[model samples]
Target chain A: MRKDSRGFKIAFIILLSVLVVVCFLLGNAKGTIEIGVKRIFEVIMNDDGSTQRMIIWNIRLPRMILAALVGVNLALSGAILQGVMNNPLADPGIIGISSGAGLFGIAILVIFPQHQQFVTIAAFFGAMLAAFIIYLLAWKGGIQPIRIILAGVAVSALFGAGISGTLVFYSDRVYGALTFMNGSLSARSWPEVQTILPYTIAGIILVMIFAQKLNILILGDDVARGIGLNVEATRLSFTALAALLAASAVSVIGLLGFVGLIVPHSVRLIIGNDYKYMFPATALFGAVLVMLSDTFARTVLSPTEIPVGIVMAVLGAPFFLYLLRR
Target chain B: MKNDIIMEVKGLSVSYKDNKVIDCIDLAIEKGKIYCIIGPNGCGKTTLIRTMSRSIKPQEGHVFLSGSNIFKLKTKNVAKKMAVLYQSNATLSDATVRELVQYGRFAYKEWWKGSYEEDTKIVDWALEKTRLTDFQKRKVNTLSGGERQRAWIAMAIAQKPEILLLDEPTTYLDISHQLEIMELIERLNKEEGITIVMVLHDINHAARYADELIVMKDHKIFKKGDPWTILESDVLKSVFRVEAQITKDMDTNKPIFYAKKVI
Candidate 1:
């Protein structure tokens, strides 16, 4: 049975790799002008200055890469948060990481348009600050998931209020901030991908290295500590990493939810929770989920594309209900 | 610092809010003996064992393993000499038995390194000893309470600990399952020479298995001695507030008691 499960996990990983490739092809080929597979590969392999090649190079490809990176960052962040909180439902948004980032991103777009260049930095700072405060509120000589969740919900609501207050007063500037709030990827390109790429790389590497300790932690606190883990230390460091990954993705894409929730939750439901296996699997599948959903969002309304965040929320909220019922 | 004294608790106290659960307790744990702590509800049996295991930090004083202050040592270093089993095995993980057992090597592992041959061998030995090899593929949630309890013991023993502190290891199991767990624990103590300190609700089971019994009352040691000495009517009446009828087991020559009433 063990051998069977291992084989299945391996097959599932290979299948995910194939799906990512398929999404790349589907995403790149189905954009405006509808290039053929042969032409897509031709453009990818050779960068001639033709219009289709220019379209793929300048517009379609960067958005696809950024979507894929956002998928990775949010999914892995959710997976790490789940591990730290010891709840399969835990994600960046549960602890106000994304909300914090959204508040700051909106604040910059409306309040400090002059400092637009540092919007990503501001979002990242807000995410860390909110996460820090939540952790502080949760820690009463020891950390408990119940306390963290309660504190997080309160923190998220406060930051969410900050965002609404900003929007209510700056109603004239709401258009500029609306796309940021809705997590639109309309004009995102190479610069956006480059911004999020470092965090995705760093997050994946760190999670992989500490995967075993993560597994140890899910054994619950007494066992984790009895087995030699510094439970509080492990939880704090991993949670900080979760905030970092979520912040990077939120800084780029605005307030996207459910990529964090759905991808990791589904991956764990399919594959088991072996962290070593879960991390890579979630990364690949996160990329696939975002790419496919973003593709659907891009084409569903005939170029009147809704933000991917809207697509995710519409899909994610019900899936979350399904998870709770299960 | 005597060679046989495996652990020592000195002036240790623990409290939750205004209530002092363990009030300045002191005790010496000798090597390779099975010790059972028993008392009425809220008498601090659980807290005392938890403190001894270093899972609960006391507000005052120290618990010494060997001669060093246990709290002063790194948790991993403490784990090398002692292992603890908590009451509940509830977890969000669907990790299999072998996977759960594999983490017992965490105390001995390097994060960047692969767990080598010895780790696997020890894991295999723990599985074998606990008779969990057949069910090693099963998710921990799927295991029976008795089986899961054994699997937890398997994980603890994988540490090769010198002392095992268990908090009500057989609390909620059926009679047969409880005996199975007790017999397994007895085997671990007798064969491996692991000093065992456990909180048990069943005084009769404690009398049957323990080399010594520690009776607690009001967060302090009421009495502690051999079961034969500690299970007498007056002692039982004094500490447990119960009238006891005591007799010797014919087969094991161990004292057995039946509580008549709260007096």
Candidate 2:
């Protein structure tokens, strides 16, 4: 087990380094643009009256950071949710948090046009509200994992209808809403990154603090309670933290599905179920996947970027099906 | 017996929604003795055990552990005093034998304390006692039902509590495996000076293994005494609604019961 963990850590580091290089190259490249790895590094560092410097620093850097941040947040949230619920398929998007955010984002754009920050605020609230509803529905003295997922599906469908209704009614706002709803890293700036970073950081820290409790919780509620953990409280807190991470990710980048679900499950298969390793490893793996996927999205259709969510879904859906089969 | 009292319950009752699962009852468990509670299905034996272990709260009454109210005490402190091995079907996956055993040390561990030498030692000792040292690295999912039960026992043992409560520990095991676990538990009580309180469905096993027997009927204690006193034909017929022949084993001189048919 020790040797396996060591090998995983080494491979993970190598993968992360490769992702960084690929992200740097894709982010800096433009029309008929080709730059060496050494020059790319210098351009990122030097800021010496170079067009590459401007491209690296201003536009691509924030996008890359957003991609990494959103990736880590979503994947960690998924991992934590799976552990707390003790279900391999449990992820923020599948459990209605992402859909709720999408619905609220649409409502804000359609109804409250003047409040520009409405999308972010509404998305966060929507995610929290959806989670709260699931909690209440599942609470019959204590929450059950199957009930939580069922409630999530029910709530997700309800909010999903709301989103579709808004989209049909306000067709004129379709372009803006559609772009944001589909999840794009195209419009990211420093301010957007700054806004979502605190919540992501805070949520990740909370997950780390509660990671050990989550491990105990996997043994089931009775054993968890017997072992002296406040099982319900710990589960609720982790659920909220997971929602916070998902909501924050949605607020900044819109609905990026499958990254959260796929990254953590894949990591678990590789690393085993120990959350101490699973949590950090899932975060890194998620970030790497999104960084790589975003690079693909930008370069594949160069100058006209396909949404990163599209790339993720295209890649993630097949992998998810394979897992289901397995 | 009074001096040996390690756990005391006063007017304890537990309810689920409108239905009371464990009616008002009192129980006192002695130190270093194997006490078994036996009853028909849904007669509150498991619920009573859960209440005693503090896994479920009593609706009306107090459970005192070593003369202190259990509910009022910190859960970690309670965990340090008593360890519970609930029914073995509780969903756990992919955890190795060593990993599962190490969980018993959670209450003893501080937040900043990483897995230490002492934790490993306790885990090793538990695995040794359960005779699962060879299977220490095996995933819990890979173990047979008997080995899994032993693993759970190892986990409880790793807690190193003065009192151990088991809820239907031998439910799914083969007869031989059941005997192995019962013998192991009996040894723990006799040699390690740990108080053993268990819920058993089999009257014969209870009579054979338990030093003291508690027969619960209709969510209350119908009788409590030494197994030799409680495992009589009349008591068996009344509680279990079955005709039984009671005799003494010539070798061990313990009460042995053979159920004939429903009364």
Candidate 3:
């Protein structure tokens, strides 16, 4: 937001552009029909009925875009929650939002397998419900961050158990549910992207518009009120917005863990806590982080793809531990 | 409903769970005066101030700021008339003095719009008033406790409000830093005609700096008058449960108290 940080901004922009290009080229572009960057561009320019064009157009491109969008949603959601809750460690998953969405996702996967298209909608409701429950539980006098977190831990464990019990009884769908729970992007197509696109865009627009308020909100609720912020209304709306974003991501990605947690924390280290810069920066950085990690997950084993959640946890856990020590 | 009344509360009562923290309190604060509320730890001083600022909602009654019901008005509109510095300031992760002060101008600007030149000028003026002009770019966390308190006050000052509410503005500071904050507050009241209502822990500081004092006992106003008129040993004993020597300062002609023991 200041002139002094112009160089860093420009550098990060360039870095993000390069990473976007790399992600587009490498996403699912492996195995027997590996498409080169030039070939990928040619296919994008002219889509034939060939398998190569199909891989680039119908499969990899959509997957890549969806990954990036999910990253944007999750990171922005985390950034806003961290600000609203006034806690750096807050993320959608840690606060039980992702798990709440995950419960609905598993329900759809198991019970309403025929109505798989309803997963995103169900997840949104579930996420909002979780947020509402957390808010309600934390409402002894007013919502305290510690209480929300404690309630979150309790609620998350509840949802986690629900997911486990559902899977345990319905062991027939365990493979699909396990992959989804581990947060894989395998076999993901344009429909999944279409499902979350409008919500993701809407969430981003809302966050960008309200980013300045988020900056004030980080100053504590009472201080925010002093500055004329309708603290309760603003916080509720932002929480709903955050829940919507995280739920959208969860429905498609199946409870991806650390994109929300790591991206905002890392971006704050680069840019300060001013949400004007921090939100956008978190968006770009989160997209790149997820895209790159997804690429690694796909190519590292070459056809035996690992889950992106595993990749993120491998990368994020140490960073989290280090931050904790600091 | 006096014309000079800037902020007035009528029959205000606030309850937390089952306990009534502030009970049926009525107060009318005249414009351009420094009023301090002093009592023991749990006498609801903070709650009363918070209710007046609309930070705490009363169970029954309304707070009128500039003749408008504070809770009924839009938050930004109420903010234009009064700004409050709550006791526990939210810990900012990384905020420069300038950026923190810029938040004070939030009510003036649209969400999408940048700070106008006028806003910038006011922010600069606020920083200068708090003697933090040179430290504008310094992160607030990096400042000393006294300096951080000044930053918070500067942020409030940037609101350009007629009334400023401070809850224990000098709780954690050393004696000299306490004096520094009290002096700054006194100067604001005198020079800018800012009506200040603060909850103070120290009886002497309240008596020395405040033009008027509201002594609270058992969730009610025990007494309200000029510090010189009300600073008696019996009032101190009943209100704060302390045995004290009340003396007049020859220089300031204000009442000063020396607490010998907590009775």
Candidate 4:
């Protein structure tokens, strides 16, 4: 067991290194001229040296880091929710958390146009509210995962309708809000990265601290309590953490789909479901996948950039279908 | 008798919405004794056990463990006093047998302190006792039905509680596994001085294995005593509503039952 985990860590490090290099190369390929490898390397090594440094550090760096952070957040949230709910299908998207955040983001954009950060904050609170409602509605002495999913579906549909209604009523703000709703990284800047960094870091750290409790929770509430865990408290805390991560991701990068749902599930299949290892691994893989996807979306057409949201949907939908078939 | 009374449940009643599942049931569990609650399906046997373990709150009663109100104590405190093995055999995702067993030590350690040497010793002892040391590295999903049941038991034992509550521990096991588990429980009671309370469907097993037998009917204790005294044909008919013959086991001279006909 120790050997297997050690080997997985080595492989994960190699994959991460390769992805980092690829992201650096692809991210810089977009400017007036294709930045050479040596220049990009030099730009990273020496701060405040050249125009390449400004482009890499200021413009592309924040977006790249934001993409990575949001990816890790979504993936970890998805993995934690799936484990707590004990259902393979219980991703943030399936349970309506992402849509909840998107709807709230739309509302903020349409109703309070001056406060852009309010949209992100609203989305965060909205995701938490949705999760809380799901917990309360599904609870019959204790929260059951099946009931929670059912409640999530119902709440998600209601929010979905609310978003559409807002779009219809406030047509002027429709285009701007649509970009955020669809989950894009085009508008992300250093400020956006700074906004989400604290929450993402705290969320990841909290998950690590409670990793053992989560493993017990996967055995179902009754069994968890049998071994002395405060089952309801543990579950509520986990759901809140997941909601925070999901909300933070949506707030920064719009509503990226499938990263939260797919990355963690795939990791679990590869490395057995011990969350201490699973959580960090999922975070790394999620960050790498999103960074890579954003790079593709930005540089694919070069001059006419495709929104990262569209790129991910186009790529993720077929993989989702393949997963369903499996 | 004072030394024996390790756990006491007084006037315990549990309800879900408006429906009462367990109604004012009282029980006293003696230390170093194997006690079994036997009843037909949905007779509140499981509910009673859950209440005693504080997994489910009793609406109108108190559970006293070593003379303190169990409900008022912190969950971890209650857990240290007693451990329960629920009927559901749900496997955790990607949990190895060792990790699962290690969870039983959650109450002992604080948030910052990971598993300690003492925790490891207890888990190791439990795994050894349950004969699951060979399968420690295996994922819980990979285990057979009997192996999984033992794994759950190993986890409960790792808690090292004074009292153990098991709800239908042998429900899904084959006959050999069933006997193996019963013998393990019997040994734990005799050797470790741990009090045990269980709910059993098979009256014969309860009669043969348990030192004290409790027959619950209509959400109340219909009879409670030694299995020999309580496992009469009349009590069986009253609780299970079936006509049965009660006789002594040839080897152990314990009460044995054979249902003659369904009434």
TM-score of each model, in listed order? 0.95, 0.92, 0.94, 0.93
**lDDT per residue (tens digit) for residues A235-283 in model 4:** 7788888888898888777777778777887777777677877888888
What TM-score does prediction 1 earn? 0.95
Q: Highest TM-score, which number?
A: 1
> Model 3 chain B: which ten-residue window has the lowest total lDDT?
B106-115
DockQ of each: 0.77, 0.62, 0.73, 0.74
Stretches of candidate 3 exceeding 4 Å from the true structure: A1-6, A28-32, A48-50, A108-117, A168-175, B1-3, B111-115
lDDT of 1 by residue, B197-227 (tens): 9999999999999999999999999889999
**Cα RMSD to the true fold for all candidates:** 2.2, 2.8, 2.5, 2.4
Off by over 4 Å in 2: A1-34, A102-122, A140-143, A164-175, B89-92, B113-115
Alpha carbon deviation, residue A147, candidate 1 (Å): 5.4
Whole-model alpha-carbon lDDT for candidate 3:
0.85
Interface RMSD of each: 0.9, 1.6, 1.2, 1.4
DockQ, computed on Cα atoms, for candidate 1: 0.77
Docking class for model 3 is medium
Worst 10 residues of 4 chain B by lDDT: B88-97
lDDT of 3 by residue, B1-263 (tens): 44499999999999988999999999999999999999888999989998898878888988999889988999998877799998887575577899999989988886557558999899999999999999998889989989999999999999999999999999889989999999999999999999999999888889898888999989999899889777863787877777888788999988889888988
Q: What is the C-alpha lDDT of each candidate?
A: 0.87, 0.82, 0.85, 0.82
- C-alpha DockQ for predicted model 2: 0.62
- What is candidate 1's lDDT per residue for A1-326, written digit by digit as tens? 35339888888889999999999888888855798889988997898879999889888889889989999999999998888876666667766888988788778878788877777777877887888888789877556777887888898889878987888899888664676666878889999999899889999899999998898888888889999998878888897788888888988877788887898888887888888888999999999989988888898886688888899889898997887688
- Top model by DockQ, which number? 1
